[model samples]
Target: MLAFLVAGVILGVLARVLHHEPDDPSPVLTVVLGAVAAAAAGGVMNLFLGDDLTALTPWSFTSSCIVTFVLLGLLEGVWWRRP
Candidate 1:
């Protein structure tokens, strides 16, 4: 849980830094999205790796950050669509 939160915050900050613009989504929203993505990633990884979801292992942390970044990028795309 703590690891997820930390990863989420890091992911959120990075997303904001990369996509900082006048019309970008709010930081709070991004942070929440990142947190959720991290949790989902942990769940999926645990499903495949048979690891404890609550355990803050390196694999879990890395996987969570990867998923969170990917999810945030996708969400940003949708949010910034021209059409």
Candidate 2:
């Protein structure tokens, strides 16, 4: 849990820093959001993986961040941006 929180904070900060004209949420909010995301990711895995792998692990944390970032980017239409 603590590891997940720490990882989430780090991920959120990096997301903010890399935002290119980024309007990031407040640091505290970012952490909270990341935590929520991490939990959701774990829940998804639990729902899907099913009796095979343990739900929340280092891989889960990493996957949670990747999924969060990708989803955020997708919603922002990164690929459709004008360069």
Candidate 3:
């Protein structure tokens, strides 16, 4: 929903700041991708650990951040790794 989308953008931007990426993903695309990434994360968590999300709140956003970082981090490591 709108809340998820908005929070996704904020989370994405924060992740970008944390990683110091130079405009890797546009803000809007980052948000949209983040939303999908979040859903994938939640599904993976539930399927593997039986964790279920029954509510969306501050905790949801925090979870989104964690999920986004993990997903993006892997992508970054694979494609953007520095030696």
- Per lDDT, the best of the predicted structures is 1
Predicted candidate 1: what Cα RMSD to the true structure?
1.6
Instruction: Report the C-alpha lDDT of model 1 over 1-83, residue by residue, as the tens digit.
Output: 77787788888888988887777788998989998889878767776788787777778778998989888998787856567
lDDT of each candidate versus the true structure? 0.82, 0.58, 0.59
Off by over 4 Å in 3: 21-29, 39-63
Better of 2 and 3 by TM-score: 2
- How do the candidates rank by lDDT, highest first? 1, 3, 2
TM-score of model number 1: 0.84
Give per-residue lDDT, candidate 2, residue 10: 72
lDDT of 2 by residue, 18-74 (tens): 664554445565556666666566556655656233346656666777766664455
Query: Cα miss at 45, model 1 (Å)?
Result: 0.9
Per-residue lDDT value at 60 in model 2: 69
Model 2 bad stretches (over 4 Å): 20-23, 51-55, 71-83
Judging by TM-score against the true structure, name the best candidate. Answer: 1
| TM-scores of all candidate predictions against the true structure | 0.84, 0.57, 0.49
What TM-score quantifies how close candidate 2 is to the native fold? Answer: 0.57
Error of 3 at 19 (Å): 2.0
Model 2: lDDT equals 0.58
Residue 83 of model 2 has an lDDT of: 68
What lDDT score is found at residue 38 in candidate 1? Answer: 92
